[model samples]
Target: MALDTLDLGVLAAIVLAIVIYFTKGSLWGKSDGEDVSVPRGSSRDLVEILAANNKKALVLFASQTGTAEDYSHKFAKEFQSRFSIPTMCGDLADYDYENLNEIFTSIDGFQLVVFFTATYGEGEPPDNAVEFFDYLENECDDLSNLKFSCFGLGNSTYEFYNAMGKKTVSTLTEKGATLVGELGLGDDGRGTMDEDYMAWKDGLFDILKDQLSLEEHELVYEPQIKIEESVLTIDSPEVSLGEPDDKYINPSQEEAQSLNEGPFDHTHPYLAPITVSRELFNSDSRHCIHAEFDISDSNLKYTTGDHLAIWPSNSNEHVFKFLDILGLSEKKDVVIDIKSLDPTVHPHVISPSTYEAVVRHYLEISGPVSRQFVGSVAQFAPTEQAKAHASKLGKDKALFHEEVTSRYLNIADLLHVLSDGVKWTSIPFAFIIESVAHLQPRYYSISSSSLSEKQAIHVTAVVEQEKYPNVDHIVTGVATNLLFNIQLAQNKVSNVKPVVTYDLAGPRQKFAPFKLPVHVRRSTFKLPSNPATPIICIGPGTGVAPFRGFIRERVAQTANDISVGKTLLFFGCRNSSEDFLYKDEFVDYSKKLGEKFELVTAFSRETAEKVYVQHKMLERAKEISELLNDGAFFYVCGDAARMARDVQNVLIRIMMSERKVTESIATDMVKNLRVLNRYQEDVW
Candidate 1:
């Protein structure tokens, strides 16, 4: 069966296609000699890496937004410093876990593995941990010699809180792994994540001391990374002044154009132009921005229900204040090169970068100060009184919360208050880099349908501003206010000043004219594949974001003469005239869809009694029950703390009343819907 010339050509073409698909056409690209790939640590074999390094303990993290990773590094650092046991910190995604037993048996001594995992959307393991979870569940069988501990980071408001961390412990135990201590769960919902982590660390240390016959050393600060002040100016091509990667720093014209091209992801973001920016609400005190990004040129794609990750920069005010407090005001523009001293530790910021760039773009400079961090910084205090105050705040939880946490004081704010405007020149810049969490991108539910717009991504964000009773300073949201400022700049809104000033022009004025660094994140919260499947969307306030996409999606389908579903949206706001979002747009949708579309309004402040979406949902209980019976998809988006819960409860009540079922049975029915993916939520 010798192949003909045409058959041979076809075979060659197929092979070429396969190569192109796998390599994303990089196989036939121009040679630059430089590796564009991210620096993942050497070696994927966990046991081999540990054995080579002579590390008795391995701390692995599965992080979504760097929190879990940060905790793992912190744990590894402390474990080594206190127990004198060399520990290696690794990303779970980087290491292979097939030889789990070898870590204990093949290693020099009884090796220990510690997991710090954050549970992502709906009890799912984060993107990086998926393969590990699959292996643990289906492939892995034995781990008799394994000893492990786990600490989970999560928001208590979610139903499946700390699910991945708990899963790790349970699965490992089932496979004969011995658990060292109780699984630790850090709750962000209660604002006790830091405190919870601290408590867990102390308890874990106590257990390790007894079990391993380890001697505790004084927990002195040791910098994992070396930061040296470089002679390079900000204008130097080698210096990184807020650019995400090497490719973004002073690229050629062709390279600049390529930045907007795919594959846009978490590592690579597209510099999207702001096509539209306007305020949604008419209220004076509060504001909601409805901004649209033009992805026409960029190859970035999205669906009806997805998230847009907006990379933001710290405000000029915050950055300057932080530099001033740290006594790095004059040296802010001076370039500094950062190199990791330990093999396991990776510097978060790109080097060589300026102090201003690190503060503005790399580190989270405007979040609540950590209690443990306060105690750590006490030694670096400018005065004895400041040191004592810091020590007291660190030791006493109540006082720390009262003075720092409740006041929404950041690192600089806390330092200023602690020393009464004295500069803390003793604190090492490397310590600052190690202590603070890396600045993370904020995600918003995209408000436009890809089917309708195709090339545009819409974001509906409510600018968060909270004025506490005792605190004179208002706590402003980092990302939302940034978006608001961008909106103001784009629209040329005069006479009204921005709440916070940002370097919107970006590095080297690359992002000049209104632009933002954005990437799309796919979500499971999607519309049904069948166009005729009815949907009940309860989204109060800005939670209505995805539902708007849902409605517009159905409208788009209708334009194609497709049999559109009976779309129902329950929206609640403070007042109908003031904060009713997308009011006119919904009316236009209603006109287009006619009897198929329904907009249920719940204006809380309009009446004597404050009414919400749940109350409105209850009013349409019979309709909801019928829709459920007819295989309608149920969706809820908004505050996970209360609104989502209330809506779920209301749904259960609707089922119980309409179907004459018991409360338990109704609850089970709702749970079943969730399991079947008929019910979904996009809440924060």
Candidate 2:
């Protein structure tokens, strides 16, 4: 209190230093302060990016799953090496719109090509890229001199093929970004996507070559990582398995229900009691299972949208063969370190965990192989015989289809056939893991109402059977097989149990083996909060899964003071008499919920000309228009990529014809429906 001015001055100086040090950022960053120069595409980080002789080109990919990302990374590497154009892979979220605008506002001759795969990965971006893309889409940008190209990967089977790509290209063009090549699209369902991309690549490169206006050196293979034998081994990568992340990894259930937590997961799977499994169709050739898992534990609770991840083991038949070829079944403890020349690639071509794990849960060595895989590993062939055989198999689709897919054989089986039981390549285990999608859960549309059977989850799926040109028949769907086993246990038909004697249980006893690992997903696709809002459901065949739950909910609830919306369902099948599934159940439900439900059936094979759900909607255009005018919501649950699109088209036309609305008007209504969450389709 009595301090002199000098002492006070020193204290103030110290305080000022601390304030200036911490608050300096705000002082210069003030909106009204002196203007600071900002780069277009380059952010503050790019400002400090040390200049090099090679120019930088930003490559951005809008990927759902990892497909677009994989391809984008591959191309980026090629661009870096061949043209010597230093490349940086950018996510849409990382840079600001203004930063990108700055990068393109001037005569910077660099390019920004976007690889987009339309459709949601977990409803948008592969759980990793959604926020970034959303930011770019929302933020306005100025790209006067920027040149870009778009390559979209989609499934023609789905209605919204390359939708994101189409929307993206339109928006960027609006912002004045010049396009370098024709917008590219790849379709996966048709299986022509890869070659289609290859076809487009030539034309794409021609345009890129012109726009880039740069010389091309010889394109040579340069892997990003160095592959060596057992030289660089680390602790096996730890898999988080289940346990939800930020996005609520639990199932999408309409109501709370018990869930099984353990005795099942990526690492340890619950050999849940399979109560029921049966053939959905009477086709001996096809394999489909209708299974119900006993979820008696609160920890195993699931919502409707959650997927049940099943840890699958290679069939013992295939496992034994793999062991024979690798000649390592007896050497269980001999651990191997894998290092691929390409770090992007996995080091272990097999299982990184253990032999017991491989046979029990890892990918089988024997199965259908891709042309890409054959072409990729061809260089590693040990002999001329191996090279020729591999090259032939890679190019010959017929051969691959007949020998691999038809038999449902894995790598080990094929090698046995190819090498006549010779020693298999000492391929690393990690490669197999990287090549295959982690054993994803086989999702079933809950076929029953949660109210009636809170713990029971039901799914309807047709078995798959394909016989290639003069080849053995093959049947598979790892989880489906388990479903079949569940039916057996439920019926007590055979003493066979779904649970196997595996390491997960550590040889302990259980209720006869085989546990189903499942989780629930919460769904926004439930009945409207106001049940009075009418709904039009169009689903073909098994697409009717979710609709079942929707109807069940309406029936189970009391109607004392409710405006139960009229429900119109359009279901299609091959033959009405034999394949009209849940026919009796629908009739019973309709009788009880009269005026609240309407069932429409279309059979594609009933007549020579095939009729689908879309045709039904068009035929009832007048009625549909009236329903829409009454504010009815549209639900297309079956095929989002195709049938959904087709139904949407019919809806738009109906609006145009009956409502006397323009096509643009109809489109606006559709977009509004989307924003309002009215036009919802759960197609896969």
Candidate 3:
């Protein structure tokens, strides 16, 4: 119950999951619960469940937001096809772990594959995988015959980077499971994660040969399903998309009852109508917009700490670059049919959609192209000369990264430089789908309370549009620009505005037919269950999103019953006069809450030097410590890499200096916030 890896049944489940992960595709898709929820006495089936010779490769995903699940499916697809391994995918919660050793002892002829697994929230395994990890660490069993490999994905910025994967691998090895290779570490801290993986893949292959005495086989690109006369589409057309129709928007009684889970997700999306939009910038630096999407038809619900994913398309300019480089801008056979031998995360490229859709929607071709992507498809050149050229470019990373990614060149642009209009056949369709995070929604923190606005959500997004240090004319964010443009469009259409000029047939037609698809995700960061809890908040710039909602809820509660605790907000900005957002509104909140509310402002650019939110926290350390001692809930919402961590350090110092406690004890005092549910962070 305390989340230690000590249960016998839990240990059994972890072994089974590690062993049977690759078989997710072969068994589960048959609509059989038979292969799932490992039964109490099925020891033999559990072992066979992991063996790949005749069984499915289990793909057990420990995911926070489905990214791991998606990547695991893609790996499962390639693993099954490349090695003739069958895959079975499952969520960690599916198995009860009541009998895990049966799984541990039976992994002799099996292959174990893990993807993007690690725990958040103080190194506890992801919410769903908690029990499994605990069981594996605490349980006892031998798995010497086990053949396994691991791919650990985590950001290096965290304290316990990939600790879950590292701990699991060590625990399994201690129990006699023979690991097939060196652990694969995928660090997103630096931008070179993809490159780092390519190196890891090569080393993993070498280790696999030495451990299994396996000979290298020609890994041909084979799809699970064969397409005959199939169009060049990547995904199924009938799957579901497009704006809601008249029948789709407002549902009948029965339909409403059936709409508990929204059709909109990473795989499928509901394109809602835009109800409002507006631009927030006056100069050419960048644009920020406030826009809302109507989701009445879908059952998507969200709390204040959630994020929204938006799907966007490549600008026509980038599309042309891809077309020109591939020399397919004029060809008619530029179609693709994707097939997976295993269950794919969501075969992002399997479209009846067309080659254009694959390039524009399925792939991030317009963004920076890693040298590994270029190397992977290099042999598929249309001509021998081009193949040689591509090979050289791949080996010479400096030249490639500089001329291509640095120049903002896409895949198509690179292909054109290597080839002279010839065609090659060695490239695989699986690489594109397997290589990336899906082109889905980018999340923004909710700036409004659902209690106050009910159906409406507010997000204060700052557009990131600027040129890089070396690159010219670069765009900052895809979703931000999309939102900003939508805002401008709405303002022009409104009859109340006076000084507005927006041409429907002007230069912004690349996003000509723009509609938004949105979905919500839940978060555990919530307000205190009791309204009488005192709160201390620090929100600098747009980081103020959640604090606004927190204050609103408190203000509303006070208005209703006249019972509440003190509220203090530490707000920071560049200038008090130029762009101090929510300055006027703080006065209103203070008046409503009377002496119970306080607002502290810090202007980073008030003078030649700059000051930020963390400085303000130190300035009020005495008050902050006193409030914490009085059981006040503290919330931090801002940049995760620096500001959040800096503020944390400041809080620790306050506890140390003012309370006269040793560093270690002060650290625990801060950690106690998480344990007592008094401290929370919504930083990404």
Which number leads on lDDT?
1
Candidate maximizing TM-score: 1
Q: Candidate 1 residues 24-113, lDDT tens each?
A: 544643112212222236678877677665678989888887789888887888788777888888878887888987788887775588
User: lDDT for every model?
Assistant: 0.88, 0.58, 0.61
Question: For model 2, how does the per-residue alpha-carbon lDDT over 1-684 read when each residue is reduced to its tens digit?
Answer: 798999999999999888778764446442212122431234524312212212367667665434676566556666666677766554454444455555543325555544544445213444335565565578766666666777777766664566676766777788887777878888776766656665566577776678667668765445433322332222323211222221112235632122334433433344455555555554334434555666655455555423444434444445566666656567433434233332112322232234434344444343455555565445555566876787787677678666655566666666666666666555444444444333334445666666545776666665433455555534344545545544554465664433222222211122245455455544556667777888888888878877877777677654444557888999998876666767778998898689889988899998999988888888888888778778888887765556777787888888788878899998788778877878887777
Give lDDT for model 2.
0.58
| Model 3 segments more than 4 A misplaced | 1-60, 65-109, 118-145, 170-176, 217-220, 223-273, 280-283, 293-298, 327-346, 349-351, 383-386, 393-409, 416-437, 493-515, 577-579
**Which portions of model 1 miss their true places by more than 4 Å?**
1-40, 252-254
lDDT of 3 by residue, 58-110 (tens): 65667665555655655665555555656555566555543344444455444
lDDT of model 2 at residue 503? Answer: 28
lDDT for model 3, please: 0.61
How displaced is residue 591 in candidate 1, in Å? 0.9
